[model samples]
Target: MSAKTIVVGNFKGGVGKTKVAVMASWELAHEMNKKVLLIDMDPQANATTLIARSAGITEIESSIFESFENSDLSKSVLNVKENLDLIPAAVSFKNLPKFLYGKFSDDIDQVSYLKTLLEPLKKNYDYIFIDVPPTISDYSDNAMMAADYVLIILQAQELSLEGAETYISYLQFMIDEYNAYIQVAGVLPVLLRPGGRVDHATVERAKELFGEDNVFENYIKHLERLKAWDITGITYKDHHDNRAHQIFIEVVQEMLDKIEHFEGGEVNGE
Candidate 1:
């Protein structure tokens, strides 16, 4: 079966986009026993760092940049867990735009190159999650063109909400301009606090803007364990770690349910 590619993104930074991408992939692979591939398209490579730390790898010999240069992403695939693989990103990936411009004269070809490269590898995994930078750039364009769906992260803030709106508008632009076949899977809220006033109001505004049905019910709560994982890598040595991981499990279940609904031919708002 071909993998369903999903890009986790936001137009604003510091919104936990990587957290959702990494944790969701981890949950899908470790908890649900699905074969998952996470492509770190962001040049910052935070996803690559975290996953590498989790896998106990201190050095990366090759990265997605090498794969892009070779036009073979499968060669860069690194096993991160039992069912999870990764195409690590490097600082060198910042040259992707120059690389694309050198290769293709057509704008569409430049943007959709990742789609062509990913087609051969799609059949090997159940799901492929991409983590992109928080901006409108070649990285995000390639990811959106390659993806089947986008999971927009809505952090509880005015700017974050605006970023999500901008993200949807850009997605529509991609659809209209390049005819990219991708859908908005859902808007997932990552709250600053469990029941903070700003958090609650931001979510309400998101529901009003994106429609209630398109917003996910399983919002991510503020968890300190998540921060710890960034430094120490993902852990399940104690109840706190499991509790933190459980949050993503619930989120993934809802995400999969939404995906199934979309696959069943039900429109998101209807």
Candidate 2:
């Protein structure tokens, strides 16, 4: 089977999107032994910085911008691990919207550009993850269009929950108008506290809005160790006893299950 492209996104920032992307890549590469390429589509480049730091890469000589300029994904790909690779994003991607405006024919073709650029690399990896920016822009559009499934991440905050609904509505709109290939992998809740009242309430409300099955049974508890790992360039394998690491392993398992069983948006009349 071809690689399954999953975009980790939410219209709300500070929702731990990068953390989840980084953890998922680690789990897929080291645990599941999957060849994974993580594309950092966020101009903030948190995922890029995290992976680069972990790989001891101090200078970023090439990046995703090169792919946009030359349609050569190879130019930007960094082999960070035995099975993990990354297409690092730069702050320069802030200019992508203006660049895309003049490059593609119309809105439809503009969003479709990423799929064309990454098509040649599809067979090289078992999974590809796109880490998108928080807002609706050419970057997120391209990621969504290029993806087979989107994994929406949100914290159990009021604004985050509201933004999740808005983001899903936007996805539905995209499916109706431009891409019918994408469906939601699941809505993952990152709880600041595992059993906090706010977290419980938010999960229940999310089930009410998106359906219980649409949300994953497992939730990632907020762990301070994760932040330290990000800063220290420590992989979960090295931090073997950390509960956050175990939680991510469960999350990865759930992702694999969902992807395996996903009927496709087109098949489900989405």
- Give candidate 1's total backbone clashes: 0
How high is each candidate's TM-score?
0.94, 0.91
Please provide, for model 1 over 82-104, each residue's C-alpha lDDT reduced to its tens digit, 9 standing for 90 to 100: 99999999999999999999999
Count of residue pairs whose backbone atoms collide, per candidate = 0, 0
Q: How far out, in Å, is residue 191 in model 2? A: 1.9
- Over 4 Å off, model 2: 157-160, 193-198, 236-241, 263-270
> Which residue pairs in model 1 clash with each other?
none
After superposing candidate 1 on the true structure, give the runs of residues whose Cα lies further than 4 Å from its correct spot. 157-160, 193-198, 265-270
The root-mean-square deviation over C-alpha atoms between each candidate and the true structure, in angstroms, is 3.1, 3.6
Candidate 2 on 37-76: residue-level lDDT in tens? 9999988899999998888889988989877988788889
- Please give the lDDT score at residue 101 for candidate 2: 85
Give the whole-model CA lDDT for all candidates, comma-separated.
Answer: 0.90, 0.82
Worst 10 residues of 2 by lDDT: 261-270
lDDT: worst 10-residue window of model 1:
191-200
**lDDT accuracy of residue 65 in candidate 2:** 84
